[model samples]
Target: MPELPEVEAVCRKLRRDALGASIVQLRVERPSVTRPQDPAHLESETPGRRIESIERRGKNILIHLSAGHILHIHLRMTGNLYVIPDVRFRPSLARLWIELDGGRGLIFEDSRVLGKVHLHPAAHLARVLKDVGIEPLSSAFTLDNFTRAAKASSQPSKIFLMDQRRVAGLGNIYAAEALFRARVNPRQSARSISKPKLANLHTAIQDILHHAVSSADAAYAEPGHFAEGESFPCAVYDREGEPCTICGKPIRRIAQGGRSTYFCPRCQR
Candidate 1:
């Protein structure tokens, strides 16, 4: 799944390339990828509509269009969005293609087909995302708000961080990295964390996510990194058995909520 940083990266790219461009056409190769249970609505409503802006809420991307319509996309897992200035060759598993003015195109490709595309009125976007939690990068996600939410949960700290209803846009990678940075064990219960420790965790979350976005932006600013699909830099995520960057102890991986969480067991206690 594309986490907050990845989604935000894609959102920024869309805002730069796709905004103000009129939707020339829409194609859905796999019908199940779209919502409303009807693929025609996407094709019918999107044409000739100019893209106003693109934003990221939680892990979903919102393409705000003229006429008060919003196109929502969830890149669940193994899903990616690419902007092609000129279509030299279409990539494999390209599920949805949006033809734009000036011959530029946006392609949504997912090998697993777990992603979803939905079209709704801009007014209904709030309703559609009603269940999503606060944006972690927003000013509203204050330390008090974070502590209050943590105090109410007994789930493991990593699992708590992954809960969208608690704090939006956190996934296994960020959760583990944040926990390690705060020196808090991922297996610790959320409510068992001290206020000071929670404060550290809060700071770690914001700093790590912001740094991830910056790194992504830097990478994409380069000419060919986006089309080549380069992997984002990470501190400990997917680094199982690697030496901890801080303590030099081998990092560990554990199963939490059926997801693999990587952390420095020696450093994160």
Candidate 2:
């Protein structure tokens, strides 16, 4: 799944290239994407509406439209969005395509078909995302706030971080990386962390996320070309059995909450 930084990269691309481009047409290549919800409402509400702006809320993209509607997109595992010249540019696994002005088209492709797209009234956008926790990149996510949130859970640190209702936009990749950076074990209970270590964890989380966004931008010529997972280098994520950057011990991958977590056993204690 695309985490915070990956989704931010997508949002930046959409805001730069697709904003102000009215949706000339809407095509749902996969009927399953429309779901039990009627596609007619999406077709009626999307077309002719200009994409005013794009914002990243947690791991989701909020497309603000001129028609007082917001197009919410959750690019779950193996899902990505692209802006290309032709609608038929890459027809392999496109789920939805937006025909925009200026002969450009935005395509949503998902190999697993787990991504979701919904049209919501702009006024109710808050309700749609009300359950999401505080944005980690925001100033509001101070050590005090993090401590308070952590007290509400006793799960492993990695699992606690991955909970969107506790701290928004964290996934296995970043959570593992953040725990490694903080020198904290992934299996440690959230409430068991000390104040000093909690402070370090908070700083590590922000630093890692910000560095990822910047590194992703520098690595790709176009924001639309950036992808998460292996595309971004990690300190200890998905490098199982490889030597840790800080310590010579082999990086290990363990299962936590049904997700893989990579960390250095020696360094991340």
Compose the digit string of candidate 2's lDDT tens values, residues 164-225: 99899988888998898889999999998888889999999999999887765454435445
lDDT score, candidate 2, position 182: 87
Top lDDT: which candidate number? Answer: 1
Q: Estimate each model's TM-score.
A: 0.93, 0.94
The candidate that wins on TM-score is 2
Candidate 2 local Cα displacement, residue 194, angstroms: 1.2
Error of 1 at 215 (Å): 0.7
Clashing pairs in 1: none
Model 2 ranges off by over 4 Å: 223-231
Candidate 1, 127-172: lDDT as tens digits: 9999899899999899999998999999999999999989999987
User: Could you give me the TM-score of model 2 versus the true structure?
Assistant: 0.94
lDDT of 2 at 16: 68
